[model samples]
Target: MTEPRASAFITRNVLFALVGGGLGGILFMFFLIEFDHFTSTNQFCTTCHSMTFAETSYQQSVHYNSPSGVRASCGDCHVSEGIIMATYDHAVGIKDLFKQLFGADYNDPVINLLHLPDAAFASRDWFRRRDSATCRRCHLQEAIQGTRVHTAAIHQEETDGKSCVDCHFNLVHRPVPERSTFKREAWNAMVEQEFGLEPGSAEQLLAAGRRPAGERPPAAAAPAHGVGNGQQQAGLEP
Candidate 1:
């Protein structure tokens, strides 16, 4: 009787321990996934400070001012409508994860793409196309109404071409409005001058910072005299 009781007790303890350990592991995994998924840092919409321009504009727009109290993150506007699309976005994020880890290709505003890998050049096109989709998704109602000038451009796209954000991103969520311009001709010419892009069908709508390559613009140039170290870049125009 004594021997049988001891065996039973040992078995019960082992089972309980195994169950507890499994549950703990599962909970930890869940916590990690949530932490990675919902963070402001993880979202591509907030990936670049330049991207946040529209975020600021929306906060001040009629959407936020209305009594209904509607507020949205970048995901709400930029993500596609289906699970398939969401999964695709996550798949693409793996590259970004590596970039963040290595501190490669950071954007301007210290948050935007300050450096770009000229090697995988198609990535920029992918980013722009996706952003354009997000614009159409949220502004579809407004586009239907045709209240804004850009909406006219949206209507012209054959299929997926109508993303209002592609051309008209003016919002900055922060009190400071950073002025960034996408100079189509000058930027391409500059990038070609530096990178020596081969002659081919090039996308003209690509975005570029107003700053000159390898040198900061006068407005963004370092201040002659300041309170702190000269390392600090000038804040964007409000």
Candidate 2:
């Protein structure tokens, strides 16, 4: 009789433990889901001092100030879709956290400006590597009917294995050339003329990963947008 009672007690406790564990797991998952959602908001993204420049430009762009009232937050463009990719993107973003805490004096606008080129290039490259997947999340190629017929034609047909970033970059952030046409000489000149930065100062700072001075290279002309390859290089300006 005692043996039977002990067996019953063991079984009961095992069942109760399983139920408790399962409930705890669900609550933990719920917490993670809520945290992810909160982090995706524009408010959360621009909280860092480094992101203030981005926020200022984004707020003025068509993404935030559209006539149709359509608004795309920073995450909608930068963060990939689906839980797996989204989580991975957030993981990669931990670099930004580290930089904010221990990296450059990004609190200064001039110093921050020097680093913007690196950030812009890195982001554009990420989009290209991902085949501009985040852009595709909202912009379906087949569904695209641009104001110009040439634009829609470019979307559906005759092109290289080009992604959206190939042509339609500079949509939101400070205008940088599409990667294919990005010349370091042009960039150096633009920054010099635009911000009074000496040519190659950015490259030096980027190379050092901080605000260190170095020799300035000769400047050249800025990049101009070209309309070629059925790629409507100048689409509806945002």
Candidate 3:
């Protein structure tokens, strides 16, 4: 009788231990996931001084403010939507943290790119490859209304595989310039020289009409009707 009671007591304790441990593990995992989500917020992204320029530009972007009252944050654009892709992004972010700490100077474009060519290229490539799936998350075709004919045409054309960033690369953050070398007027002049017409000008509209059948303007040259056409068209901003 004594031996049976002892054995029963031991079994009960073992069961309690297993159940308690399982609950504790689950609680810990929940907190960890919540913490990760918190860190992905816009506020957390601007915590680093390296993001100062990006944050400044984002504040003025359509993603930050629009008539519809819907807003997208840093994570919406930068982080992947799927669980697997987001996990991979977090892993890559860890490596980027190390690089930012020791290898690159965020304020010095030349030195930063020189020291982190791979990182720079990787970022550009990621933008080129992502196909604007992140943007589509909110701007789905069914949900979007009042799309301009030109904008609709561009969306249809992208079925050939061009990503959104290919055209809208400067929508949020202009390319960081070399130290003390960025000038808006000079940049505008360079653009006008390359594209044969100033953006949003009458000449640009005429040039668009005259542009050869198969030739596409450089991506930096905003299309006459697509994502870069400023605020006139609806359902184009992301």
Candidate 4:
């Protein structure tokens, strides 16, 4: 009797473990929805104190404070709404989270190309394509029906089955110039140094240095005949 009870207990434990494992796998498969739900919450966005800057800026942005009273949360634009799309989004999020948690210089520069995972970047473009598709699914009739400014800007030929996000991107997500403003200023300073001019002197030089060709410095005339400015024999001069 004791042996039978022990055997049954072991079997029950194994079954429970198997069931739990299966459920975990299912949740993993649909991780995007879970991630979207997490990010949708105000707590998630504001959890990091450093993110206060982004939160404040977003609040004041035209999207949040629009005259039409269309208030959208951070996740509305940044996340996919549909279940499957959200799952896909979650997969991408997992990779991004990995980079953020384990990356060498994570959060140091906040936006460094070198630190980005290739998979995450590619997945981002993929997400944009998906979002464009989502937009068209609902807006196809409207697109065909009317004359919005976008219709003119986006020729049918240009769309060619590509996502609108391919051409249109959020200002926040736009690529930073490969060179920084400081780098541009530094380059200009170097150019001025090369020309033996200071930064402020350029305006003065352009303002006062102008002279007609007639008023320009004359070329030294050929030494009057052969008596080359006293270099020739003194007797050669009349």
User: What would the per-residue lDDT of candidate 4 be over residues 4-118, giving only the tens digit for each residue?
Assistant: 5666666877988989999998988677556668876656865653344345545666656778786666566555767776666656667656654654332221122122223
lDDT of 3: 0.55
Checking candidate 2 for backbone clashes, the offending pairs are none
**By descending TM-score, how would the candidates be arranged?**
2, 3, 4, 1
What is the TM-score (0 to 1) of candidate 4? 0.44
What value does the lDDT take at residue 147 in candidate 2?
Answer: 97
- For residue 22, model 4's alpha carbon misses the true position, in angstroms, by 14
Task: Residues 1-238, candidate 3: write the lDDT tens digits.
Answer: 3446766666977989989999998998786567668767988887875565456657777777777998888888788886567767777788767756764444332222122223334665776677777877887644433557666655665547666555555456544332234443443333344345545442343233233334434332332212222222212233
The most accurate candidate by TM-score is 2
> Positional deviation of 179 in candidate 1, in angstroms?
15
For model 1, residues 1-238, the per-residue Cα lDDT tens digits are: 3456666766977988989999998998776555445642325455554344344445566555656665555565444545556556666666866654554323332122222223123433454677556555556543464567766655655337534444443232322212343333333343333233433212321233233355322222212112112112223231
**Whole-model Cα lDDT per candidate?**
0.43, 0.67, 0.55, 0.46
Locate the minimum summed-lDDT window of 10 residues in model 2.
221-230
Residue 154 in model 3: lDDT? 59
Taking all chains together, each candidate's TM-score versus the true structure is: 0.38, 0.75, 0.57, 0.44
lDDT of 2 by residue, 1-238 (tens): 3346766766977988989999998998787667667778999997886677677777777878989888988888888887667778888899989988888856545456556667878998999899998888777988888898688788889446998887776667666555455565554444455545666665665555554344332222111221122122222122
Worst 10 residues of 1 by lDDT: 222-231
